[model samples]
Target chain A: MAETGQILNLRRYRQLRNAVVVWLTLVVLGAFLLRIPRIHILEHTARNLYFHVPMWFTLMAAALVSAYHSLRYLQSGDPIRDLRAREAARVGIFFGLLGLATGIVWARFTWYLGTSLWWNFDPKQSFVVIQLLIYGAYFVLRSAVEDPEKRGRVAAVYNLFAVVTMPFLLYVLPRQMESLHPGAEGSPAFSDITHPIMRLVFYPAVIGFIGLFWVLYTQRVRLALLEQRVEMLQATMLEAKS
Target chain B: MKTWLRGFWAIFEKDIKLELRARYAINMLLLFALGALVVMAFAVGPTPLSARVQAALLWTVLLFAAAVGLGRAFISEEERGTILLLQLNLRPGAVYAGKLLVNFVLLLALNIVAVGAFAVLLRVQVAWPGLLALTLLLGSVGLAGATTLLSALIARAAGGRGALLPVLLFPVLVPLLLSAVEATRSALLVAEGWATAADELLTLTGFGGAVITAAVLLFDYIWLD
Candidate 1:
């Protein structure tokens, strides 16, 4: 009973740790909000800095995590790694959709309504949508397969292939199309105009979003593993009773 | 290396012979190409063959024709359950090369036919045959690589063996399509030299090489399952 209580305390400590992280994030975000207006050139676009760019960073981190887990799964044949891969993919897709939505909103404010162009067919937008569809197909493929091993193998293989397209779709295709997404060649991010002060906050924003993604991904993997454990335990109980 | 090439040639010959015997894939592709051209004619309707319209029509026909042709490439294998048999016999590299070769040849033929039809129907003049031929070669390689990879990906999914191929393929193929259209357009307009279309052609070749390398590396893993 004492040992059980200690294990319970450890779990509670982890939960508290997560809550503390969330609280700290909220406080930092509040500070970021206060700092945005003073940045002069970034006044109107400042709102996008908090939402759009962080989501893109988070999406990339999630995708890379998914790829890492996929490679590990292929090497080890471990179901836990497969679960991690699936969870990362699911989180990656969520952030991907968020990035698209936020981008459209930003575009509406900056380009569509303001510049009077309803649709530009920007290469970044198109490629991101394609990335979403490919992963969406990944999930559909997963659900369609009944055999667990085959599902894992197939999903891992597909994930490997799909990730290879990322560099082309994200970087090469957009640059070749001469996109307006900023930071391709002469965007402010790469230029001297990127104030030293802006990098200070931007770096933290990236780190904070990645941390948030990690929290969500770890929680999801735990839930999945717990569910699998319950299923296995129930099967064992049934076998013994039989 | 010799064994791999032999396996590749064997599979290539088998697909070619099978395709030749039935003529289903080519026939359907040709019919589809002609029908698309007719539809395009009606759509563009004697619009004086402006450079933009001519380029757009040529690419549309080629894109749709390749889509149709690629969709059928794996259908026979799936139907006859020969994909498994072939997979057991040949290395994944050989399978990829053989399939790509067949698709490349078919796309080359289809491009020729589509380009000829566009020249006649759309009244688009080809100024530099050599530059245009180079563009077609690079563009077709990209198309073949992308389509082959996508067809393999979609082959295993339920009902995906048909519709999902185009859905996954079209978005990625945009760069190639854009480059091909621009290069062909510049060539038609008698742009001073290859300099105008060089950037687009280089982009296509770079993308194609990357995709082919990736497909070759990943195909074995994908096939193992």
Candidate 2:
């Protein structure tokens, strides 16, 4: 606990955490209060774009952070970099699950209204589930290794591979298929189709969610560092006694 | 350069001789694939499943058989205590190439068996045998390369010998498998849909090339670790 600040730069973390709270508050307000033009079939449910889209953006941001740390781990062979990569992945997958749950709810009520179907095989949605499963295996792989340095090296390599697969799984392959979700020729890609008023909330929401991911990721890194220190201390005491 | 080729050949021949002696992994793969096809035939009951459904089923079975086939990529080395000695003697890249070649050869043969069963039992006809073979070739390259690396990674983990292979593999395989299924569908069933399938085949080739290239580059890290 005493050494945690040294590991995490506590002041900067606190500052960012505070800023994120206030920032997300304002984004939430804007999200609920902002007025926008409405259209058939989407109506008010279109507001979900702010919340749902940001989850994916945050997940991607977290993935990039994780992969960056993994690359550094491979280059430097640092355990701390391994810890950062692992925590960032854990947080990224959290955001991914949230995104999936939100998408299910949003789709069930909006496009799937009265269909009695909770999980229609939308290409993007199905592909995202696959993406999440890939990430899920990362943790399982982590759990299967006992040596700290070896685990770090192997998991870093695997993490690099996982992140490399992310773009193809999440976007490239799905786009090629006949999905009911737009992004095909007839529809302005979700980016071009949204309202200017919504952009006000959307941009901040993206930043805020990413900020939230950072705060959570940093928290995990600090805690894991503390745990590592305790293990070191215990190992030293046993060595001294022996 | 000569030594590198020699090292590669040694590993490739070792794996081939090992397999020939036991005839174990490939036999299990063929049996699993044939069993799955027979089960599907029973379940679907003679009236032909749609071409798309047939394609999906075939790819699914092939992917699973691949999982079982190459999941033992490094297990024999571990069991025989040769991994450390192999690492001492061979470049990791050469080791990767050999293992990948072994998987490629084994999976390519197993794939032919599975495809034959799909045609005979599932009553699916191949409209273009050459194109179907090409699609299988492309699909198996990615399959062999990826499973070889992943199996090696899993071999040293706390988990038993590649038990987690498919769990870690299937998601990453989706893109390759999807393209394989589509190309197979077009090559075997879809009249002149072959023209439209050019992009899918290209994607398959690129994906296979990228995975194999990356595996060769990165295998040293996990292997030596």
Candidate 3:
């Protein structure tokens, strides 16, 4: 057991240490590329090309993970899958909020003044908020139940249901309704206006953000499993002492 | 075939009998629907009722009232521990079908009351009663399927209050709501023909069928847990 633990710890440290260096290098490169003065001619809105788009990519990745775990939980009836689903949900909520925040910031820079309300009742915005509220309620519902099996089952079911609605809320409704947000019909970048150079950074930004979300989700899942193990150990110790 | 139909009717009858004796769920729903319509009338005070606004008002009333009814439907069963008894006596499919039947009836009632209130208070005209009824039927099926599944989900959760119920339900109901609103708006518009609204109606029906199929398949899994 000791040898296995040492090996796992060494593996985690080695992988994560190298990953951090690579991530930092990319960040530095991205910053340098973004800082060139001529790039400002692309319009202040172009700043969103890096931040807002990546946040959306992260949101979609997290939601997909949540859905995957939900399906696993249903099929296996395992508490671990439920935990993964919950972690994915939490991470998805964070990215969803980040998307909203960054979109708002971009909106302020390009369209609205600083004094404008942070949230408008735009269909996409409303739908995303509704999605967040649903998952927020999922977490609240899980904590409220004391029985682990019931908590896992109910949260898994709710997560599945929420996942089913996300596409409609995020894509269908916005496309139907008139909206100020870009990309109702196609990619966010306009074909006519977007320089090929922008796509170079933009595509990588999406990939990097999705990668970051995966890392966070993995860490969260591990933390949740550890918490469960600790709780089980504590209960066992109490039983033995008694 | 006869046995299956009998089983479905028996489940439906059982729910109706229970509600009839208690008079809790239906009464509360009707009263809530009426009250919401009254409030909405006041809110929209003296403004000329455009067909779109009237359709929106009617939907708002029905949605909120159905939320109240849906939350109460399983909650009363849970509080009385009747769900376990019912589970032991009937198959999950039968129970689902019956609960859905009761919910369909309840929503239909609320829809009737909402339409009446809209006509009386807002002076909105319904151009095609047949088309409108068909639209409501399709919309109610979707509503009942989603509500039944959600009620079962929340019935097991902690703090499964009125708060958690709508929070869990509204997201799932968005497509239904959108389709229903579009169909209802089109039906109310004198200039727009039924052909124009056919796509929305079809979408609502498709969604309703999908939700019902999902609920039936998934209920057994949920029931065991």
Candidate 4:
């Protein structure tokens, strides 16, 4: 059995976890405290740029990381790779949900303020929700397969298929539609409108949230590995008793 | 190469023969599609829907109709215990290609019937009938390519056979669905040449190509296991 310490550097995990915590603290503080030129209707809600957009960035990062692990799992047939892939997707879904929720709240107050419409089917947000549903289906698939090895291979295959569709949902289709989201057909690209100063906080917020995702994903992977080890030990003990 | 083609044809012929005899999936597909079209027509009443709305309705029906029938491609094999027989006999790529062809043909027939019913009942005057046909053909290819592999995966899954297919499939098919609807809308609404819908056509073709290539590459992993 590979040592858990070898599989994951505990000391590095602790260090990164702490760093993410502190980094995110500064990010949140900067998000609210920083001054920027505000446009009509957006006003202070523009601060959501720090929070809402980063969730998507983190989700994308998590997805890529998960797909990479799934590909590795297929190549090597490593159980640990499956665990890592599943954990990354779970955490990615968490961030995606956060992104969706924050988007609804942000939209309700800004664009749809008087209409009180929480979701008017903004193309970008709707597509993000669909992407999240794809992730949900991945979990459903994982649950349906019984054998661990078969489950791993089957789920990995599905995950790869799902991931390949993500780019189309996130980028291509949304671009084809009229969207309130920046960088859509009529709207200016993010680089054009976003103040240069916001990038300092925005970029870090994205990195920080992805760092947070990494911390959460690694922690779950460690727990899953331990659980697998315990199950193996129990099986051995049962055979011995027989 | 010869053996691969032979394997593909054998599976295709057997499936076609079985389907012709049983008519299980074909009946389900045609009935569901026509049913949905009638329901849509009655629900809309005499109101004249714009081309875009009509396109959306058509694809929605076709999508659900596919959900109803396309899964039988692999689920029937699993149910009949022919999966083992197939696993023993053919290459995984051949199996995937054969099933994909079956699904494409099935979906194409359903689309034609549904679209025919939709135009007749709803009084739709398609400006570009050829483009409409082209769009439906391309749409069927992409839908079949995407769903065939999914059908295989879902058949191996233990539970939720009925529910899992669409849940796993609909999201992945969104791009194809979007392009199909757009192209169909143009075909029905505009008198312009195919150049107007060239972008959507390219997207549909690319999506179909990419999905089939990926399915061919990955079907081995699912099939052997």
Candidate 5:
């Protein structure tokens, strides 16, 4: 705890946390209150653009941050970089799950409402699950290793492979398949049809959620550092006694 | 340049000879493939599933077979404690190339047995055998190269006692698998749209190249460490 006090800048963390709280509050309010031009089927749920889509954008940002840290870890062999990479992925997977859950609910109420269907294996939705499975493998890979240094190096390398597969899995493959999700070349695209009026909330929602990711990621990093310090102290105390 | 090629050839030949002598990977993979084929047939019965489902099943079995076989490349070396010896003898890059080549060739051959058995047991028929063959060839290369590198990563960690390989390999191979399944379906259909099949074929080729390129570029770091 004392080591955390020395290592972490409490004032900056507090300020960032406060700002994220305020920003997300505004986002939630705007998401519900703001007027969106109603499309035929989407109706009021068109407001989901503000929340559901940003979850993916935040996920992508988190992936980029995780990959960046993994690259740095490989370059410098820095344990701190590995910590940042792991924390980013952990938070990223959290956002991915939320995105998937929200998407399921949104699609249920909208597309499959009449049929009582909850999960339809839409191309994008199915692909997202595979993407999550890849990240889950990273966690499994980490757990199977006993040494911290070997775990970090191997995990970081595997993390790089995970990131390289992201675009092909999520975007390229999904778009190639027939699906109810957006962005087929022959159809009237979702991005094309979205009301410019919704962009007002949509852009801010993306930024706010990403800020929220940053705050959560920073918190995890601090906690991990504290745990490392505690372990070090325990080792020193045992040495002293011996 | 001659020495590099010589080193790669020596490692590759050594791997093949060792694998052939032991017959560990090939026997298990062939048995697994036959077992999966028989089970799928028994479960679904000779009902002749839709072309898409059939293609999906074929690719799924192929992926699993690769997972079971390719994962042993590094694991065996480590278990015998010969990985360190090999590392000291050959360059990391050469060792990587050798392992990948061995995996790619073995997987390609294994897929042949799987697909042949699949066609025979299920009474499956394809309109374009050439294209289907091409698809299987390209897809196997992509799958093998990627899995070989991942095998090294996992072997170095857990000593090869986990489901990490399949879980990791599946998602990475999704793009390739998608293209393969689509192309296979088209080949099995009576349709003659040559130009349309080009997209799937091109995607498979592009994906295979990309995976191999990435493996070549990154294997050194994974190998040396």
Candidate 6:
């Protein structure tokens, strides 16, 4: 408990949280207001590049953070590291789902316009769904463990294993297939399709959303720590009375 | 090295003896695979199927059958209360290697029966029997590696039902599955034979190698914990 106060800096978190709010607000404004060259299918929905792609970037960032914390937990046996890992993954999954939803909508409007198809089994989209299921299983694994310490260790190990497999899901296998997503074979990559001006907003949006993930993750960690503290207090009080 | 091999052989022999005597896990796995194959054969009754479809169906049956039966090795150990005794007597690496060998053998047996049923029912024409065998061997390596470690993890978790096994496994297995399906399809189609399917075979080999190494390294953490 000596390190409880040191685990999170409330003032710093608040500052970053406020900055992220303002930054993302500007990003959304920039996404819609700024004019860019329109491709055939992706006329105005090119704006989704700012919103949709950033969610995956944030998801990947959060996954890396989660895996890092899990590795640390394994090495040090720190429950705080485990808690951070779980919270990071929880937020990462939120972004992954958002990425998936936005991808579906983006695909429906742009590519699958004439046909009534929400999911046509784009390789990238399918892989992302599998990625979400893996994280979903992580949450299930955590809930299935009764003891907090054991849960942390077991969940941390699973998290690390999942992260190790992510490169295959996100990169190797997807690249081997024809994808509707940018950067695939036969598809124009970001450099070709995306206007340079869009990168100005897209990069910032990625940073902003990742910052937002950090804020949300920190808040959850703080709430969880408080709950843990209260449980310890109740246990101690019961012992004293008995 | 010698001691490790000896320990692994002991565990492997013990499992084989138990499997021979009870035959519970293997029988259930075989029956499950047979039932699924029959239903699949009936569902696609008398229709001409593409090589891709046949390959996909084969791997799907293999994957699901594995999902159902592969966890029994670890789960049974936990259930029988011999896990602690085994833990005390053997190194985790040896235990993992032994279990992986056992699971790999079981998966091969299941694959043989399933693939046999699949070929006969669907009237599969194998252009390259050697390539198909190689694909199955590589695919089984990755599948066995993944399920064995995950089964150990699942066995320790409360409420870790049999259902959770596939949920955790399928995602990690996507790369291997994709390559396996492709290689198998190529083998059946007689398209470009070994040359074109070489990429997929390489991917399968790499995936199996990497996963097994990771499992060996990580098994200690799961076992000791």
Q: What is the DockQ of each candidate?
A: 0.36, 0.62, 0.57, 0.65, 0.64, 0.62
Which segments of candidate 6 are over 4 A away from where they belong?
A38-40
Off by over 4 Å in 2: A1-6, A170-172, A179-183, A238-242
Q: Please write out the lDDT profile of model 5 over residues B59-121, one tens digit for every residue.
A: 888988888777888888887888888878788778888888888888877878998899988
Q: List the candidates ranked by lDDT, beginning with the highest.
A: 4, 6, 2, 5, 1, 3
For DockQ, candidate 1 versus 5, the one ahead is 5
* RMSD from true fold, candidate 2: 2.2
Interface RMSD values for the candidates, listed in order? 2.9, 1.6, 2.1, 1.4, 1.5, 1.5
Output the better candidate (4/5) by lDDT.
Answer: 4
Candidate 4's displacement at residue B127, Å, is 1.3
Query: What are the models' TM-scores?
Result: 0.85, 0.95, 0.89, 0.94, 0.94, 0.96
lDDT scores for all predictions?
0.76, 0.83, 0.75, 0.87, 0.83, 0.86
| Interface RMSD (Å) of candidate 4 | 1.4
- Which wins on lDDT, candidate 2 or candidate 4? 4
Top-TM-score candidate index: 6
- By DockQ, the better pick of 3 and 4 is 4
* lDDT digits (tens) for residues B7-103 of candidate 3: 7799789889988898888889999988988988888888888777777777777877787777766667778877778777677788778889899
Higher-scoring candidate on lDDT, 4 or 6: 4
What digit string (tens of lDDT, one per residue) describes model 2 on residues B1-225?
Answer: 888999999999999999999999889899999998899889988786777788899999999888877788788888888889998999998899999999999988888788888889988888878788888999899889889988988886654545688888888888888788888888777574668678778878888888887787668888885
Where is model 4 more than 4 Å wrong at Cα? A1-3, A170-172, A237-242, B191-193
Give per-residue CA lDDT, model 6, range B34-97, as digits (tens).
8988898999999999999999998998899899988888888887889899889899999999
lDDT (tens digit, per residue) of candidate 4 on A1-242: 46456757888888889999999999999989989887999888899999999998888898899999999998989788899899999999999999999999889999888998888868878777887888898999888889889889888988998777666565456645667888777789999999987998999999999899988988998889888889999999999999
Model 1, residue B114: C-alpha shift (Å) = 1.6
Screening candidate 3 with a backbone cut-off below 3 angstroms (N, C-alpha, C), the clashing residue pairs are none
Candidate 1 chain A: worst 10 consecutive residues by lDDT? A1-10
